[model samples]
Target: MHPRHLTVNRSRSSSTSAGSASSCGFCPQIVQGRAPLGQAVGRWSDRHRPGAVPEEGNPREHQTPSRLRSQRARPRATAGRCEQRRAPGAAEPEPDRRALRRTAARPPAEPPRRRGRRRPAGAAQLAPATHRAGAAQIPCRGARRGHRRVRHRHHGHSSGPRAYFCQNDHVTSSKTSIPRVAIYARQSVEEDQGIRQQLDDGRKHAADHGWTVVHEFSDNDTSGSKERGPKTDWARMLSAFDEDEFDTLIVTETSRLTRSLTDVLDVTPPRRAMRVIVIRQGIDTLVADFQLKLLVLVAENEVKLKAQRAARYAADRRKVGHPTSGKTPHGYRWVPAGQRDERGTRYVVDEAEAEDVRQIFREFLAGATLGQIARDLTSTGRLTRKGARWHSSTVRRVLMNPLYAALLPPAQPTGQHSMAAIDLEACTPGAWQPIVTRDDIVAARSRLVGVKPMHAGTARRWLLAGIALCGVCRKPVKSSRPVNHPTPRKDGSVAPAQRYHGYRCHFSRNGDVIDEFVSELCIQRLSQPDAVDLLTPPDDEFDLPALHTRRDALQAERKNVFALIGSDPSRLAAAQDRLEELEEQLREVDAVIAKAAERHPLADLMGVEDVRAWWESRTLARQRAIVQLLMTVVIKPVGMGHRPRRPQDVLASLEITPLI
Candidate 1:
């Protein structure tokens, strides 16, 4: 087939009249009775209409406005030009419909030589669009640029075949819109990248590009690689993107926005006309060489490998009882690398904080409740390192932590009870100086017997809430009754019962009367030599139930870790190392539990000169501790057949029995 060619123009001349098919103002191709080898017509005007003409001296591929208007005349195979070979008064030659169809697309004279693979025999080689007719108007993959429109000047010649990229155009004509952008900044806990620096660079980039900064968002010490914790700014930026609040998203680096390829896919939507510019990588999602998905994949791999290395390094640190890179634990401060080798830099006791920790343990072991300790500390203006007021939960957390006892938390501890689950006896002691002794921690742990730790904050003014039991239910009695009514009188007149705090039951007695009676009996007994054994706590040994619970938790957690990170060999290996460390910790705890010992509960009061004076001087918790330890008290029910209206009635309804 002969080479197909056409001359086209973008606009029509207003002067073309009827019966003027050969008007020079119309496109030369239309005036000559043919158009390019195309079938697609541009219905809507190209967004890049008007004079965006390239400079004449520019050597780039852009076509000049004047050059686009004129087309070089090509030799035609037909017998005559539309007008020159036709009669002056003759009607225009009727277009032969069969011939127009036969030459709609002319194949190359010779098969075009292609690299690598040979073109199949008899393939239709398309003539390049706009080779001489017009400039290339390539549509952007994700850019804000507009597509071009190729229209015929004459309405009468509108039926010619139109072509819409029977093939793609290699050259692009970018028409950039004024960018309104949102800047996003992120830094991980392990990273030292300054968020301010990222923001500053983003601002500078926007200035350089003549882009407007619509908003700025940042997350410091936040991990983009991990889908955990609050990445507040990151989430807000995504929401803004979805809302179309900004046309462009600018970040200092691709990884700062996301280390996950899925997130990368979500950020850029060509249909939404959204763009992402990564400053460090010089990547624009709208550019021809955008490659963000590949970059995202590389970033994800790097983060995964980095996580694995960090986990392994932490494991090594743990093996030697050294703390890893992270926030310093309370009561401890990091020793500088200048003071020791980089690897040897370790945690040392912070005297002020350590003293506070020791005091908390000291008071807790002395029968002071967690709330009382917290209140005392608060009253003394002693707050946490973060300057937050102490709560009972905070006090309990301090008490539960094995760090004070020179022990580390598990290799992989999850949830709030991480410290509560540590087994100091089973694990290798840390190199740092301990604020509290193992014996003190063991005692504190034993005292943490109940499920509801918040109960420690309740006021214990009534001494025998746990020590005293009810005769009917055999359950512990409490002084909770409010005597709102008077006692009964046979003559229908009322006589009020002595209104003092008492155990609420039909058979009742004053709490002060009962406490006085129990105290006298306890003091009298301890005053004797035979009660010597009762002066100190019993000799006993018990395994730590928390250690067992921690072991089971670690095993379940390891299985979960495997499930989450199993695909990556580096991360999987790191998790396996953590698992081994967990096992080592468990074995150590179990061995220690097997041979552990307990401390005496009454050791503080054992040497008091006067037992009654000592008891009076103690806090309610200590007094109740002594009462629960020495004897069992029951507010027994008395029948009508028993003594009534007698002074000994208090003794009849109350039962006090010695435990030792």
Candidate 2:
């Protein structure tokens, strides 16, 4: 195809009426016989009329002073210009006016080669519009002032491409004297460590970059082995980047921030427009380089490998039957292997603390209450490992520990209950030196039952005193009272002191001589019933018979629910959940019936004696279950001693029924 080219001139009339088409390279002409029209013919034509010019087949009779005359000369390839080279002098009689109007348009040429140095291979591509914008803003063509021009070394063949540096004005370009920086750190171990090193390096790098450390985020004791590292608070950093957190991120090294390629990629998107200066890698993300990517990959691989090795070590420990590194059991101590030489191994136990433990067991065996022991320890200047006074709970924990008994040599013990031994085996014991033998421990535990009963005034008051109500009065009451209130004194003085209390109704007693109520027995009764009922199942006749009636109804509901799932799944899901819960309950009821047949001793008893036997041998839980199923105890407020006399009218009294 022939090369395409064209020229255009906007001013070519009045000043120079001469037309020269032959000199223009793009136009070609061939002559055909043509003559000037007569005055009559010319006058009839619009070309010779007023305000008309020959250029556009119009001639202007008078020039308008206010109007600026402009002409556009369009080159045309015609039959006349192609012939009569020298004879066609005198501008070819200004070319026939009608001939130029039929001119054809020319095509544009192919674009030229790009200017300036070629960008390095593997370097990021700059948009043309961005390059244009940068060029337009640049004051000079070659380089801007205060910028250091770097002549990058060309590797491989010189014929390949020229290396270039982005003009860096690191010494200047500070609109604000604020420092721009990225802080990074990590902990190879789970505990917070080596964090200070990363911070120091980051601060130093920021200073080197002439940026102030404006904001900092750190994740101490966090490992990149899983996801997050000690220093990378990614969410906060990302938000700050969106808000333009800093001029640039200044990190000691990319690895300090992340050891994952994905994490490295995350850093760039947050502040894509902002710069990132990684000091250790010597990378300027804004400028771009292959090494930056390579370094990120290297850091990521190292993190993954470190995590793998740590995981492998953990697995190996489990295989070797060693506990994973963490807290030790209550009685045992973490014995560092280093402490073990050729001699016996040294434990991490605090000996003074361990001695107090020995005294507690001995005191318990000597008939001290756990609470009394706790108070004694506190009063006698004994402090716990935490430097706190002993609590009954803490004392009990020490007594119950089997490590003390495990220290016993294998032998039958005297007066040691087998029940205590059975309980000991249930609690897994840790390997530790025992201060007392199993026999001594059993003897200590036996004292728990034989200890002197708490006197009325000796024991502490119940926390629920005067708050928990008596079902009889529908009023709060005290469960017990001091010894002085137990019976009247023979000396004719008031039987109980004023402080010795009772559960008296505010309405009935005129707030005087309030009677102490039976509280501990009530708690023991109610709690047993509540717990047992929770464990027991409804009678099969009651539950299963009701269920059989609902089964078909539920199946129909389920079908309707399945149809609704496509249009309104949320409602359907709720219905399905209810159905599942009901089904689960039915299964539980079946399980309860099976359990009752196996464990309930009442299966063999009969009549009133059967009832008495069931009541006698049944656990508190089973008693509660039976009461809930077969009886309803209603307490109605009435005058004292007004018991229900008739069976049918069981007023102000318990109503018992066989639920079967």
Best by TM-score: 1
In order, candidate lDDTs are 0.62, 0.46
lDDT of 2 by residue, 1-660 (tens): 011111121211323223434332212321222322233224334444666654443233332311211112233232232333324353443443343343343344343455568757865453222211122121111132233334333332223322334443222223324435656565656554467777787787777657678777666665553565334576577667667566566666666666667666656533243456677767876556456668878877876687689778855543433443454434446677776445332334556666677667655543345665676577668777567987876776566545555432222243453433445323333334556555455454444433443431112233233333455655554444433334556976664444433333331221122111222223334344343443344555345345445554655665565677768756765677766875665445434433322323222233323334445543323333334433333233336544334433332232223243
* Residue 565 error, candidate 2, Å: 41
Model 1, 1-660: lDDT tens digits are 112322233222334343444333223444444543242122112222565443343232243334433322223433233344233575664656666667556663553343344436865443343332343233333232333222212222223333223212433333234667899888875354588889999999999978789999988877767663444887787777667677678998877888887666566543334578889888876553257778878889997898799889887777878866567767888887788654474878888888778767766766667876776677668788999887888888887777777787656543354655565545666877788776566667656734567477654567776568888888877666655567568888987655557665545555776777777776787678766676544345444576567756866776687687867777876677777877777666545543343323466566677877866755565666677777888888666444233337666767878777
**Candidate number with greatest lDDT:** 1
TM-score versus the correct structure, for each prediction: 0.51, 0.36
Off by over 4 Å in 1: 1-71, 74-178, 190-193, 207-210, 228-231, 269-273, 288-291, 341-345, 359-373, 413-426, 439-602, 605-660
Quality of model 1 by C-alpha lDDT: 0.62
Least well predicted 10-residue stretch by lDDT in candidate 1: 39-48
Cα displacement (angstroms), candidate 1, residue 433, comes to 2.5
